[model samples]
Target: MPFWRHPSPSLQPLSLLLLLGTLPLLCSAATPGQLPAKRIQPLPASNLGSGRVETKGPGLYELTAERRAALETIRYAEGTWKGGSSIGYRILYGGGTFNSFERHPDTVVVKRYASAAAGAYQFLPGTWEAATRSLGLSGFGPASQDQAALHLIERRGALAELDRGVLTDQAINRLAQEWASFPTASGGSAYGQPSKSVEQLRAFHRESLRRHQLRREGAPA
Candidate 1:
């Protein structure tokens, strides 16, 4: 693979390329081999008719069709179950409200979403292709090993991209393997009170999205 090159400062990754709807994407400067589903498209208009949804902050972007969508808030989780490998839960919540990780073999790295208070989700590092039954404060589990790629979470709020980024071969296999291991676990974030009232749930997402825009646009949390 070519050396990793960051996108130009002007080439903002959070901007949306609204096709039929919205696809969140950015061509990897290192390898523009195959374009990803969440592709970065130029904003044809300087003002793309967006509101709080797209203007909040954080690295998240929204897709607008009949209505504008808050982007990147949904949390897509992937991890091991036992020695057998496992797929994690799927959840969507406001930035920094509550977020975490769990590993089985190694030490569990605790992470918090600073997106709201600090304007960015405090990221946690996971080793590729290594499984550990470790757990964190915001989240839980001494998760199993799945030999997956880097666990990816979409920027809190956008529908753009698949929402999870585990592209390398090992990561892909681990994700697929773990996803295969526990079909139900891979289904949704039914693990906690991510939502109760549908509207509140919806608002959690909306609030997250606005914050995403704000973070992206350089607003402090």
Candidate 2:
């Protein structure tokens, strides 16, 4: 008889039974205390890693380099401290009436102290109109306000100094005169006007400039 031979049917059944018995233990040992947890998949990248982001709001738009710098200037100059808060439509007041610019048909008000500047950049009616006209923008919405302020920033040529983070006393004073709520180079607001301290203004400018740079570097705005 040949030494090599098939296992008997009974032996085959026993081997199969042993394998079935070890299957559960093998699986448990492979997985430890619990089964492997499922992982969530991340969102697929769009346009081959372009990293484009979609945002919502009034001022939300394509943030070009120029637009980012313009927005930074506005934040430093106008968003710091105005009327106990940042400049907005809510700040527009004159003689206790809302929207002094609207109350009077003419942009010029007979009483300078009677009116509170309006918009994010705190522009008077006359100044706002002039800036808007130059920029070919119309309306009092957030986009229009931002565009108008950008024009003023360009006209003043303050973007360079803002970019350099080296604003001179003369330069700050010139801007302070335009925005009553802004402090002079000496950290003093215009005569008979409220303004943030120089230290606060510096902090704001630095932070805004840093953020603007980060945004330009592909960080979210």
What does the lDDT read for residue 18 in candidate 1? Answer: 29
Q: Report the Cα lDDT for candidate 1.
A: 0.23
Please give the CA lDDT of all the candidate structures: 0.23, 0.43
TM-score of each: 0.22, 0.51
The lowest-lDDT stretch of 10 consecutive residues in candidate 1 is: 113-122
lDDT of 2 at 135: 46
lDDT of 1 by residue, 1-221 (tens): 12223353112222232222332221111111222323222222223323322323332233322011111222222111111121222111121122343321212212221111110111222221111111111122211111011122121112123233212223222222222211122332222212223333344445555555566678973
What is the per-residue lDDT of model 2 for residues 1-221, given as tens digits with 9 covering 90 to 100? 11112342111232444455421111000001122322222212231122122333232224455454445444444442343232343333332223432221222222322232455555655565555444444346555555555445445556455545554555556556555445666665554345656666556555655676777698875
lDDT of 1 at 173: 26
**Model 1 Cα RMSD, 1 decimal:** 19.5
